[model samples]
Target: MGILNKFLEKTKICVIAEKYSVAVEYAKALGCSKKDTYFEGDKYVILWTNGHICTLYQPEDYDEKFKIWKVEDLPIIPNGFWIKVRPGKGQILNSIKKIIERQEITAVCIATDSAREGNLIGEYTLMAIENKKNVYRAMINALNEKEIKAGFKNMKEDKYYKNMTLAAQARDEIDWLLGTNLSRAYSVIYGKKYYVGRCKTVLLNLLCKREEEINNFKQSLSYGVITKFKNDNCEYAGRLNYALKSESEARSIVKDICNKQGKIDSIDRDIKSIEPESLYNLNDLIRAVNRRYGYAADEVYDIAQKLYEEHKLISYARTDSRYIKKSMINDVKLIVNCINIDKFSMKKSDINNIERFIKRCVNDEKVIEHTAIIPLEVESLEEKYKLLSTKEKNVYDVIVENFLNNFLENYEYESIAFLTKVENYTFITRQNKVITHGWKERKKQDKNIVEVKEGEYVNVEDSVVEKKLSKPKERYTDDTLFEVLENPAKFVEDTKLKKILRESGIGTNATRALLLKDLIINGYVTRQQKYIIPTIPGIELVKDIRTDKLLEPFFTAVIEQQLQQIQDGELDKDELIKDTIKFLERHIEELKSIVIPDKNNDPIGKCPICKRGNIVRAKDKGYGCTNLKSTGCRFFISKEILGTYIDEKQVKNLIEEKQTDVLRFKGSKGEFSARIIWNGNKTQFKKF
Candidate 1:
C-alpha cells in the first residue's frame, strides 16, 4: 500500500521538444511561465533538444583498421549500426536522462517536428538514454497554442511511430555505408577527395550531362519574313509559317508579298480561363522563390525555416503536401482573418471572400504528414513587420498572395487567332485580350488586342526578312534544376523506369536543396549567376565512375520505394539492410575491377616552392604541387584572384617568367587591373 501510494502520487509529465523555439511554444501552450534551459511546472516539465541529440557512428568508430582508405577494404558494412550522443550535446543528453529516470516523472511526450526526421530525433534521444518508460507522441503541424493543446489531448502511443523511426534509421545507415565506402574507394583510386551520395551523385551527373549538351550545341542561322498588316486602324504583325534556310529564299518570299493585299481567311475567338495554381509544397516554394528573386534553393529553404521557427508566421516548411486537411478549415479562416492586407489597400469584399476561397485548398487525401505552408493566426503585421528582414518580408508576401489568390476568380481572357492569305502564303497572328483581371492582378499578364473580321481585306504596310540563329537549351538554373530533381521522367527514356522515377524523385522535398548545395560544396558543381555548371573535375568524375547501377536515377528511385515500403511496414528493416549489403558488395567488386583513368596528372607548370614537383590544376580552380603527400610541400596557387579566373596561359607565363601581364578583375568596389607574380613561396597580385 505504501509503494502504490508513492507511485500514484507522481503526476509529473515530461515533454521533450526537438528545438528550443519549439520548447518555448510548448511551454507557453502548457501554461508554464517560469523558464530556464528547461521549464518546470507543477504537473509538467518541458525540455528541448537541438536538432539531433545523437547520430550514427562514423567509420573510425567501427574499427581502427577502417581508418585507412584502401581498395582491399572496399565495402565497410556494419553488422549492427550503433548510435552515440552527438558531440557538444552530452550535457543535454545527461539532463534528459536524469529527468527520465526521476521517480517523480510519470510519462514522456515527444513534441518533436511531425516527420520522419523528427521521429528519429526523439527516438535517438530516448535510445541514448536507454529509457523504457511510458512514452507518447504529439503530432501537430504548427506550434500554435491551440494546435499544441489539441495535440496533447490527442496524443498517440509511441508504438504507432516505431515504423517511422525504423525508416529513418534505415536511411541513415544506408547513406553512411554508401557514402563512406564509395567516397574512400574513389578518393584512393583517383588520388583526389571525392564525396559521394545516392542523391548527390545523381545531381552531379545531371549537371555534367547538361554542361556537355551546352558545350556540344551548334548554332544555325535561319531567316523568316515578318509582314505587317493594317486593318480598321489597327496594325498587327504576322510571321510566315515556314522558315527559310537562306537569305535569298526569305527575300524572294518577302518580294512576293510586298505589293499584295492580305485577305482574312478566318478569325477565331475563344474565351480561355486559367485556374489558380495549387498551394506550395517545399519544392514548389523553392522553385518559385528562385525564379522570382534569383535566390538559391538552400537560401529559400533557410528563409522558410526561419519564418516557421523564429517568426511563427508560417506552418511546417519542410512538408511535401500542398493541401490542407478538411479539419483545418476553421484554422485557415482564422489565419485569413488575422492577416493585415491594408498595406496593399485591398477592399472589404476581397477580405470577406477569403473564407470561401480557402475551402478549395482543403482535401483530406492530399495531406501526408503535414499540410501546405500557410500563415499562422497572428494579429496585424504592424508590430511584427519591423522585425522581419527584407527577404523574410518577400517570402511572407508570396505565401499571402498565394492564399489570397484562392478567394479570387479565375483569370479570363479571349484568345484570337487570325489567318491571313497573301499571294500563295498564309500567315497566322495570335493575340490575347483580358476579359477579367481576377487573380492576375497580383501578376499581370500582357493584354494584346487585334481588331479584324473574317473575309476582310488588309493592306500590307511593310515586309522584311529577319535573320535568326537557333539557340541551345539554357543552362540549369536553381529553379529548373529543382524542377528536374522533382520530376525526372523527361530525362529517362524507358517507359516503366520513367514512371518509377517520376513517382520517387532523386531526393525528397526536404533534402533536394541540401543535395544541390552539397554538390557545390564538394567541388562537383559551380554556380555561375543563376546557372549551375559542372567543373572540369566534376565532369570527369561522373564520366569515370558511372556504371549500370551506380549514379543512376532508377537506382535511387528503387531505394526510395523500398524506404517507403519500410515506412508502411510492408518490408522489414533487417531484410532491407541485408539486401543493401549484398548490393554494395557486388558494386564494390565491380568498382575494384575497373581501372580508374588518371585525369588529374596533367602538369600546369613547375611548382615555385617545391622546385622539383610540378603544379597541376586542382579542384575549385586552384593549383597544387604533385609532391603534396611527400616532403609535406603545401605549394599552391588559386586560379581565381579577386573574383576573376586567371587565364591558363597567363598562369603558365607567371610560372615561367615570375610575372604575367596586367589583368582586369572585378572587385567589391569596382574593376581594377593587377599583375599576377610568383614570389618564390606563393603567388601575389600587384595593382598597376
Candidate 2:
C-alpha cells in the first residue's frame, strides 16, 4: 500500500509512458511508500500500456471499403475504430488487465509521458478492453524519479490531457486514413509500390528536387591567376580572380603583372581563435560525424541510440536543443572534470580551473527540457567504447573528444590579408596563423594560408596559367542533405515557399536519416565515394513532378504546421487529417493528368539476365525482368536488404559468366566477406 492510496481512497490510476522503462521508473518512485500512496489507499491501481498498444486498424481490415479512393467515403471516417492488443504483446496487455480487474481498484490514473503518443496508448487500451473506470491524468515533462514522484504528489485531473488525446487520436486516424488511401490509389494506378505520409512525401520531394539540380547541372569554365613569390625564408602563394576568356589571355595578364613592382596596396589583419564547440544536437552531431568520418546518418543514429538506451551515457539523443538546462550545470562540470581526469590526464588543479571557466559560461535561457548531448557518466561510455567495432569506435571517439573540448579554453589566431596592385591587375593574399592553440592543442586541426607580408617588395618566384573547367553541382551527403531538407529556402529560389518550409520540421529527427538511406537503396540515388548522387530514374522522377506542389518541400512544411498545431492545442487532429485528405485528392488527380511514364520508360537499360528485356527498379526489389514470357526470369539484387550496393557491372558479371568475381560485401551478421567462385557458381566465403 503506497502513501497516495490512503489520501485518495476511492481513486484508481494508471501509469503509461513511451517505454516500459519510463513507466517502471515513474511507478517505482510513487510505490516506494506503503499505504496512502498515490493509488493504494485511494483504491486505485496503476495500469501500464506500451507505446502505441493499438493503432488505427489497417485499410484491408475494413474490407468492402478498401481499395476505393473516393471522396464519397469523404470522411470514410470510422465512428470509432476497432482496437486490439498488438498481436505479439498479449502477455503485456493481459498483465495490465489482470491488475485492472482487482477488487479494490476503483479509479484510473493516467501517468503517461506528456506527449501525443503517450495519451493514445492509455486511451486505446481502455477503449479496447471496455474499461469504463474513472480516470485522472498526471503530466510532467521530466523523466527524473523526483519529478515523477512530485507530479504524483500534485496530480492533475485526467481532463487536462483530453485535448491532447484528441490531437493524438486525430494524428493516428488521419495517417491511417490518408496514407492508406493515397498509397493504395497510387500503387494501383502506377502498378508500382509507393507510400506517402503527411511528412514523408515532402521529404521524398526534397530529395527528388536535389537530384534534379545535380542532373541538370551544366559545367562551365572560369579563370584565376596564381603566383608564387619568395621572401627571405619562405615562399608564398596568392590567387587573383582576373576574368579571362582563355588560358592564353590569363597568362598574358600574369606576365604583365609580374613584370611591374608589386606594392602592398592595403594590409588588413585581425587575430582571433575559435572557442571550443558547445554540445551537439542530433542534426549538428550527424553533420559533423558525417564530414569528419564517413559515418552515415543512419549508422550514427544507431550508435547514438545505443549510447542513450543501452549505455545510458547520453540523455535523449533525439533532441534538437544545443544548450544544456541550468539545473544541469553542475552535472556538466562534473562530466568535464571526469573526462579531463580519465581521458586527458589533467591534474586536479587544472581540471578545477577548466571547470570554473565552463561554469561561468553557462546560461539558463539557451536550453529547453534536455541539454545538448554529452556523456552522463564516463564509465558507461568507456565500457561501450571497448566493445565497438572500428567504425563505431571512430564515431564514439568524435563524441567523447568533442565532450572533452567543450569545457576547454578558447583558441586564438591571427589573420592577415595583403592586397597588391600592379598595372591594372589586383592581387589578393590572405593568411591565418594560430596564436594560441587552446582546443587545437589536444586535436590536430587543418588550416590553409595564402600570403606572406614580411617587408615591402613582393618577390615573384613562380607562375602558372592552367585551364580550368566548371564543376557540376554537388550531391547530398547525409550531412549536407539535411540542411537543404530542414531549411529548403536556402536551396530554393521561391520566396513564399521558403518561408513556409522554415516553420516545418522538414523531416522529424527520428525519420530523416532513414529517408536518406531509402533514396539511395531505391535506385533513386547512388553513392559516389561519400557523396549521394542521383540515378537516371531519380532524375526522370523529378522532371515528372517538377511543377507539382505535392513534390515540393512546402507540402511537408504545411503538414508540419498542422502537426505543431496539434501539439500546441490550436487545432483538432481530425480536422487536420481531413484537410490533408482533401489536399491529396486534388493533388493526386492533377498528378494523374500529367504525363508520367512507367518505370522502364524513364531510362531503360539492357537486362543482364535474358538480354531480351530491360532492368527495372522498384521499392521492394530490383531485378532484370523479361516481359516476353508470361513468367519472366527475375535476377534480383536487393538494396541493402541482404547486402551493400551491387552495381550494374556486378549484375552483368553475375549473369553472363555465372560467377560474380568474388562479390565483396559487408556482412549483415558479421564482418566483411566475399563469395568464392567455383565452376561458374558460388562457393565458400573468404573473410576479410
Give the true-structure RMSD of model 2: 8.6
lDDT of 1 at 464: 88
Task: Summarize candidate 1's per-residue lDDT along 1-688 as a digit string, tens digits.
Answer: 2212333544777889988888888888888765656887766788989889999988778888878888898798776888898889999999898888888887788889888888889989998898888888988788778888888778777898888889988898888888888888877877778887878888888887765554345557899989999867678899887888999999998888887899989888999998777788899888888888988999999999989888888988999988998787777778766776565446224555555565668888888689998888986665796689989888887777777777778889898888999989989898888887777664454655778778889989899899997765677998899888888888779998898888888899999989888878877788877878776567657866746455678888878888888888999988888887888888788778877554357787888787899887665557778898887789766766654445456768888999877665546675455677888866777874
Best-performing candidate as measured by lDDT: 1
Q: How do the residues 365-430 of candidate 2 rate in per-residue lDDT, one tens digit apiece?
A: 765334566666454445656776776666666666666666566688788888766567777777
Best by TM-score: 1
What's the lDDT for all of these models?
0.80, 0.60
- Report the Cα lDDT for residue 271, model 1: 100
Tell me, what's the RMSD of every candidate? 6.8, 8.6
